[model samples]
Target: MIQDNIDTTTRQPIYPLLAAFAASCLLGTLATDIVYWWTADIIWADFSDWLVSAGVIVGWVTVIVALIEIFALRSARFRQRSRAYASAMVLALIVIALILATIDMLVHTRDAWTSVVPWGVILSAAVAALVLVTAYLSRITDAPAAIEVTG
Candidate 1:
């Protein structure tokens, strides 16, 4: 049978996971904006910065989760799975980088928009990439490898 001949338990594709993550980020952005807008009047102190930082933390958390999935949960023998997870992580980092870059750009010019490169984003991407590279070099858990090995 086809089912018997081919591997049935296939690893999930990374793009959809990324899409879902992006959606979550967008929703989160909106939610945070709304929440802060609603509370802008009553909240003590400017906690918007804290909330923005929280977004960054959430993104990093995604990276950790993906790394765990690749290293701890999946079998090391399946390099494909590991690679997939790694790729997922990389994509996630890229998304986060874009977000930060956008934020930087927006911040640079409050009234007008600019397409300046986000040094912070680049630094973060580099760090994230290095993490994955180090982990790969170290051969940490052999296999979603999504949560960014990069984050």
Candidate 2:
């Protein structure tokens, strides 16, 4: 008797993912604008400043990595499956960075809610969470390879 099993390997909707990522990037930019509008301060006066800097850095990194993943997906030279996996991994890294940055910001800005809360931290956190969820979905869809077949 012959039996057939379902093929679990399936590609995700890259366009939606890309769109979401783009939206997040735009939101991050808007958050920066909001922060500038609320808090005129630029220098690192305390831990809050550092946290803001870290958040900015993470946002930038996430944007860059997301773009790279998009490019990888569009590349014709590489296998689609491999590209998907690589993209997922990069996205995961971006999410991790965003989470760390958010935690740092929340911890440092807890005392100055009146000042920092209006400065775009909430918007930034929302964007970060969106990126994180998408990244996690990508990771789940593209599981790591178990073995390497060398020629």
The candidate that achieves the highest lDDT relative to the unseen native structure: 2
lDDT values for all models: 0.41, 0.47
Regions more than 4 Å wrong, model 1:
1-23, 26-51, 75-78, 81-92, 95-151
Question: What would the per-residue lDDT of candidate 1 be over residues 10-105, giving only the tens digit for each residue?
Answer: 544253353345334433443433444445432311233333344455555555554464556553344565566555555555455546534633
- Candidate 1 local Cα displacement, residue 103, angstroms: 7.0
lDDT of 2: 0.47
Instruction: Please list all clashing residue pairs in model 1, or write none if there are none.
Output: 66-147, 82-143, 85-144, 85-145, 85-146, 86-145, 89-146, 89-148, 128-150
Estimate the lDDT of model 1: 0.41
Candidate 1 steric clashes: 9
